[model samples]
Target: MTCRLPAALALLILPALPAGAQSLEDSAARLAELLRAGRAVISENQALINDPGLGDKGLTPEAFLSQVTAAFLARTGSPAVSEDLPPFQRALAEAQLEAMGQTIAEAQPLINMEGVGFKGFIPAVFARLANERFGELADGRAAVKITAPPELVRNRKARPDDWERAVIEDRFLSAGWTRGEAYAEETGPGFRMLIPEYYSESCLACHGSPAGETDVTGFPKEGKAAGDLGGAISITLRP
Candidate 1:
């Protein structure tokens, strides 16, 4: 299940842009979507991954990617990447996939450890590691990160930067801000994209409940309910 590809073999597949900056926007959104797709796989298999009785959880990076691919296709009606895309965009997708794979590979020991429940390979941690690897693979060409409001940030690295904070405070949190709408801009020499993420029923397991009560992850819950603004996925693409 993938989007229809350009049929003309000789054509370099580039997304049609109504404006000059749309390619970067599209590429950034694609990378973010793929990253979250991987996170969804991890989220879906939390039980199996955390089962102390089950060694070799069978969710190898390759297997995980296959699931992620299917999830992405189902979510967006597009393949994570295609031979039809132009070299740069294709390279970004490949790097993101490789980054996620490497992250899962590195966590084998923790993921497969016997008698260890809740190995801390949660989706947030997985995304952080994967994004770090993607930055290295992109060699400064692009970067992806998960950031949240200052009070809700559990990890310092996941804390919003100056631009990210502004967007979060001024746009995503505003009463008039459209739910699930993404904000993008060409800021300075790079393109920046900020996609708002909402708290889901599953997210409540760790992020919801009585305010200040500790969750399973040992972090105090923010008492966020479903549909609340949980965070955002920020992407940067440099020329």
Candidate 2:
């Protein structure tokens, strides 16, 4: 599920912007580049896992997460996140962990599913990028999204908040999306994207079941669709 941080909540947590800082659009562009890079890395890892000969050693999912997590740490040059994730993503990540754990431990078993998943980790990667770019970590419902006219995915938009909304609409008038710095601002510069089933399938294991639907701590329970793309991560900007 896509995590969304409302604009109002961001101001309460994000640090003040620096003088002569980049406009929210510029900062968001740079952040999107980082997010794309991270996504590429995750995609590459998934490809490696599915490679024909890589499984000769019989690697376990735990081993895969260990190696991949280590590579992520080494690549980013950040401290380990053993005790807990940075404050901004703690609640979000923890909830994900619980849901994922429950899926891996029970749901999958009852349903006879196999193969550990990966794409679902975008939120974590987004958090990492937000931390590096903004010097602040956003937690559950806190995140950033890149947006633009579909024709101008390359041409940056001055309306940063609009782009955040674009992500939820999944109608980036532009070519594609990138990542952005997670922050806060007056009127809450950015907006949040609601997660619906359309964006992911793993989300169903825990979120689809009636018992898990309304009770998931960090997720929304109503007006969501089977394939509905969730809300965007809102961030306040200097511009």
User: RMSD of each candidate?
Assistant: 5.2, 13.5
Give lDDT tens digits, candidate 2, residues 100-186.
Answer: 223223322322223443323333333343333332333323344443223212213312345445443454222353322233233
Q: What is the TM-score of each candidate against the true structure?
A: 0.90, 0.32
User: What C-alpha root-mean-square deviation, in Å, does candidate 1 show against the real structure?
Assistant: 5.2
In TM-score terms, candidate 1 sits at: 0.90
As a whole number from 0 to 100, the lDDT of residue 149 in candidate 2 is 26
Best by TM-score: 1
Which 10-residue window in model 2 sums to the lowest lDDT?
149-158
The prediction achieving the highest lDDT against the true structure is: 1
lDDT score at residue 156, model 2, on the 0-100 scale: 38
Overall lDDT per candidate, in order of appearance: 0.85, 0.36
**Tens-digit lDDT track for model 1 on 59-156?**
89899989998998998898887877655677677788888888999899899999999888899999999999988877677889999999999999
